[model samples]
Target chain A: MPKEKAITAEMLTKRFGDFIAVNAISFEVDKGEIFGFLGANGAGKTTAMRMFCGLSLPSSGKATVAGLDIYKDNEAIKQRIGYMSQKFSLYEDLTVKENIRFYGGIYGKSDTYIKKETEILLHQLELEAQANTLVGALPLGWKQKLAFSVAIFHQPDIVFLDEPTGGVDPVTRREFWNMIYEAAAKGITVFVTTHYLDEAEYCDRVSIMVDGVIAALDTPAALKKQYHASGMDEVFQQLARGAKRQDN
Target chain B: MKQFLSFVKKEFLHILRDKRTLFILLGMPIVQIIIFGFALTNEVKNEGIAVLDLAKDQSSGELIRQMDASRYFELRAYLQNEQQIEKTFLKGQIKLAVVIPPGFDHQLRHTNKAQLQLIADASDPNLANTMVNYAGSIVQQFQSTIFPQQQAAYQIQTELRMLYNPQLKGAYNFVPGVMAMVLLLVCTMMTAITIVKEKESGTMEIMLVSPLVPFSITLAKAVPYLLLSIVNIISILLLSVYVLDVPIRGSVLLLIGMSILFTMVSLSLGLLISARSSSQQTAMFISLVGMFLPTVMFSGFMFPIENMPKPLQVISNIVPAKWYYIIVKSVMIKGVGFNAIWKEALILAGMCTFFLAMAIRNFKIRLA
Candidate 1:
């Protein structure tokens, strides 16, 4: 039997008055797959992800997140999916443990479940000593890791990360990917959007978007071979060079 | 319900963790109550005055003693000559000088007429008016006692009685105004800043994407401030009653109910501001300029609304603090019950509903 599809978008389009931010984009991600959504500036990557997370309404077309319809079941879709943005959503004034408890509480998780999961998560992150410290006082790398842990603490089916590794050092970025791989191994699909071409090579399959449309979609190695390029970087440059929209 | 409680707890923690903001939030009511109650008052008492009694007779001594006995005036100096009156006023210690002419008892017993000159410093017109009025009343009283049945026919003796606040205490006026000002500052400005800070920090997006609805999130943010405002109201009432000697003449329960209603209106305004503002500074600016200034200017606390221009008088009707000030004065000073203030209460409830509806609509359109 074929694997279950975690997300399926058939010609999803979003328009902002006279401007088309996401124009009839089609894509699919299987369960437990690491999907890379690569795009240049102003290529509508965030706009498309917002629709999947049920934070924005689509102008036309159909999409389902975790087998729930985006239109009729927006709230239900939210329950089955988790989201973390580049903005760092955790409260800086709240202690690390308090942040976990707050996110868990909002998801309607019972106290016992949160208490048990919090200890295990804290131990795993090696942040047991800093559990009572304010999230603001922690280093940037630790804060990012803690934020990712909190995002998936409710055990959602899929997690959407928007530029989660934007300003981190290379070593920390590698460590962050290790955490992402661990989550993917547990059957939680990862749908991440980034502009870092090197990060595209770590994904199971990659899709490059240009001018509100996906230009190419395939495995990273297959995309390089098909474009007759040396690496994913060259392939991205070749696809993005033809774009009329300059980086905003 | 548990989720809502957890969210409210987090809000309280946020308030308590910031030491500077926490100090400001809790300290503002106490400081304002003390300042407005004792230091800033309009009731004039113990003002110094100089007596220029040229008569030097028994009648002059009697009148001078009467003026000095009254609480409004203190006999500070006894001027020796007519030139000393100008010198006394120029020194600024004497606010008024009473001049009893030499005609003395001869004119009063024979002609049944007497004249006295009251020279007052008009630099502060309001204070001068009040002092003159008090002095006139005292003289009239002395005259009535002296000529009990010797009044001429058809002398229309107007019997004046000051109802409610006979003494015209300034505490009775400003205590209620202070309540309105403090509640608006605490409930509106703090609530707006708290909500907008989340937006600036990006937690608002995460909140919208959560399973919890936007309505609960907004309500949770307001709940902590609602409780804090109640605490503020209690502190202000305590200070006014025990320290300032301003009593709650009406039912205490009724006064608190109306205060909570006003608090809800203020909180709804905060919600409206937060929904429209994208940054913390913008929220603070809007709250201060849009809400706080109107509360101070139009509430008729610092300035009389009737004295304002025709257009401004009409605009004062829209300010929620004006209605609240009226309600508080009625309940706290006049000792009236709900029957007297139902209209103002209904207006506040309507404003609360209107602001809350607008805020929810804007939140949906902007965030969703």
Candidate 2:
């Protein structure tokens, strides 16, 4: 019961001019669970994530991450959550080890802690050989994995991966999910947004957003059964098609 | 503070690894100093003159000899008639024409008065005025020599000594101005473009999301350039001292401190520009077009602000470089201390505070 909620949202809405990007969407994410935020492009997944990450203000709603107010305690929330942008957000000119040290330094980690964590992370990814090479020279899969590791290097309460595995081979994607599963197993909450429906099966709960509104929010199995579908893809297609029908 | 240092270290790495930025930051100051020191001199030399000696006498001959010996004029031809004078001048072959009348020697002996005509090509009015003035002075010197008693009766004696730069070398004026310009270009333009590049590359978002405050991020971007600008100042001073022979007569520490202060003002201006500009090209264009000409023209670099129109003189008062130039001229050229330059220093410090506040306010608004 104590771990039943990691995030709470009540009628969270964000608008730009007359256009509403997130329209009264609300959901809860449990602790130590992988929550999948699935949406087509322009469905406001990034905007909602930005609000949840305390990057932008919600127009007329309330949200809390790690029990901190999004408005008054944004700095506190920022210290407790980690974010890895869709755009590979590591210093391309810095080495993998240096990037880790830089992030750890900003988080006020001791130099000894940084050195130990850097060795462990590099050894875990088997990228110890590239410790001195610039991150820009690394392969895309390695960069994504390294960026994710750096994002959560300080072991925040929750890690927000905004499409962390966008452009990678299936094998690399599988490896990336393994890293995510390991982190989740360690009692860290994972909030991820992705276009890959098959990856939804890996999540403890999934939400399908269509036109700035959540059409379904439940466990992947429950969502499939509720939509009378066999998998997450059919549930998404049904929800999207239903939304399009409602729009016309 | 530790976080700020690490961020600044990363910025230095970015500047060092990028060859183009490195070249612009380090190479431009020395190159600009050399160009402004040697190539852009205002000294007029070896101007061509055509002499029409109708007297064909010793006095006229002696006047022509003195003109040739003075090195200010090279007698290109001797004109026989007024028609020839017009032809030579129209052909662009002569910049000045000296016409001595037939009765020149008789008039000097009897009436103690001689007449000479100096006609200069006015197409290039500045050079023409300089050439005509030199020619008239040479004639007056000859008249004084031949009739020292007569000169004592009707002569006006004057002694003029040019201070700071005895020869009135243009390099002495331009060296400090070029330092101001080069520092502005390197500190403001480079910082603006580099910060905009971070935004464009999406790296700024990453830095912003981290625990580093926005002010620390901006400070990190500025400190490296501040150090580099100081290095440039030293290089310019060394070049001026050894190569151009322009003296740094005041306390070196004061000159350096003023340079660093000006560099900070420029860096903050760049920050303000970068905060408003979303793209590197826009940032670069804003710094170059917005800051360059004003620093060069209105800062008393090319034209003296005292002689400028009243409106422009008032406008120049607002330019921080104008105050910096005054501070530098007072310190490096005039050998004055803080007492002599406290007013200009106060103006520069006020400008620095204004720019720093504006940049901080702009940054906050941007984040909001």
Candidate 3:
């Protein structure tokens, strides 16, 4: 049997009054694949992700998320995907368990499911002792990890992480990436955007976006070989240096 | 519905955990009621007045006694000379000085005319005006009683009776004002700030990505404040009735029904503000300066809308609080029923629909 395509886009373009925020871009991600969307600031990475997440509309494009048409089934797309941004999404005022239950509840999980998952999540994260503690009292790394856990708690078909590891220490970023790996291992497609090029090496396949268009798309090793670079960072710099847009 | 309930539960948690928000939500109405009820009253009573009796006669003495006996004035000082009147006023001891001109009992019996002058301190113009009016009325009453049988030709005795508020109590005027203010503040400001706070914390993006529709998300955010404002209305009405001694003359059901309608208006206004504002500070600023100020200025509670300029009078019609204030005053003070206030209530309902539609429309535009 052929592998399922979790997301597919063709000729996707978004314009904001004469400025092409997202130029025509085509891509595909298989089910359970970790796809890294890399770009410089203002390269339209966020606009593209927003379209896929049903947060925005494309001026003209063809796209589907989780096998649902983006234009006709925008709402259905939202149902099957989860999103976490750079800023922490969990309520700091709520306890760790309350935060988990609230998110699970909004996702239409049954009370029994939320209860069972709350226990399982607490034990998995080794936060059983601090389950009743307010999320504000938790350290930054723990908050980021918990945010990621809540995002995937609904068992979404794909989880979109936008700069999820921004501002974290290297060790915490590694731990966060481990969680992403675990989610992918469970057959959840991971669609992530990142500023750190080194993190691109962890993805199953990567696409470099420059000036609202994809300049390269391949595994990190293949991109390095094609650009004659030593690492993913050199590969990204080689493609990004040709961009015409100013820093945003 | 389960999703919405969970969302509202989360909102309640946010509100309950934040001590400051809880304090403001629960404390503001009671504080405003007390402050407006007792301290910021417009009713004047027992004002100090000096009597300069130049005529030492039975008529003069009788008139003097009557003026002092009336609850409107307190005879504080007896002045000997005209100069003493100015000195007494300068000392801030008297608001008005009554001058009974030198005359014998012969002036009333022979001439049937006597002169009386009321000198009032005009420093505080409103107080001076009221004091002068009170003293003038007392003199007229004395004149009518002294010569009841000898009726002057073409004399017109005008009887003035203040209806609804016969005692002219200031509480009757401000109780409704306080209610409008408290409900609008708690509903509009709190709703706007709470929604914008989600935007600030980055949770709004996550929420938009969820299976839950935007309408349900916005409604869930407003539901808690909607319930909170009803509690506010009940507390305000109870305080006005029991502690402040302002009567709820009309049907209690009508009052509550109209108040909930006004709360809906305010909540919709809050939704509109939240849709436009991206930050909590911006939402607060708009709610206070843009919304609260207009509620005070044009609501006909703090300021008389009839006395305003024509342009402002036109603008006042658009403020939902103005209609709410009118309905409350008519229903609570005048003891009027739904028949009397249906027009104002209709206007409020229309405003609620308009604002809610605008808010929902703006929210949809944002997604595009």
- Residue ranges of candidate 3 with Cα displaced over 4 Å: A1-3, B56-62, B103-112, B123-125, B141-156, B365-368
- State each model's CA lDDT, in order: 0.91, 0.86, 0.90
Q: lDDT tens digits, residues A165-195, model 2?
A: 8989999999999999999998889999998
lDDT of 2 by residue, B247-344 (tens): 89999999999999899889999999998899999998999889998999899989899998899999999888999998998899999999998898
B1-368 per-residue lDDT for model 3 (tens digits): 88988999999998889899788898999999999888887666778989899998999999889988999888999999988988998898888888888884658767977788889888889888888888888888898798878776787877789999888888898889888988999999999999999888978888888888788988898888888888888998999999988899999999999999999999999999999999899999999999899999999987799999999999999988999999999999999999999999999999999999999888752355
lDDT of 1 by residue, A85-111 (tens): 879889999999999999999988999
TM-score of each: 0.94, 0.93, 0.94
**What's the DockQ for every one of the candidates?**
0.64, 0.48, 0.66
Candidate 1: regions farther than 4 A off: A1-3, B76-92, B144-156, B306-311, B365-368
- Per-residue lDDT tens digits for candidate 3, residues A1-248, read 12379999999999999899899999999999999999999998988998998888899989888888988988787778989976789999999999998999899999999999889889988999999999999998899899999999999999999989888899999999999999999999999999899899999999999999999999999999999999999998899899999776
Model 1: per-residue lDDT, tens digit, B74-184?
A: 999999889999998999889999998887767887888888999999999999999999999989988877778786877888887877777788988898898999899
What's the CA error at residue A89 for candidate 3, in Å?
1.7
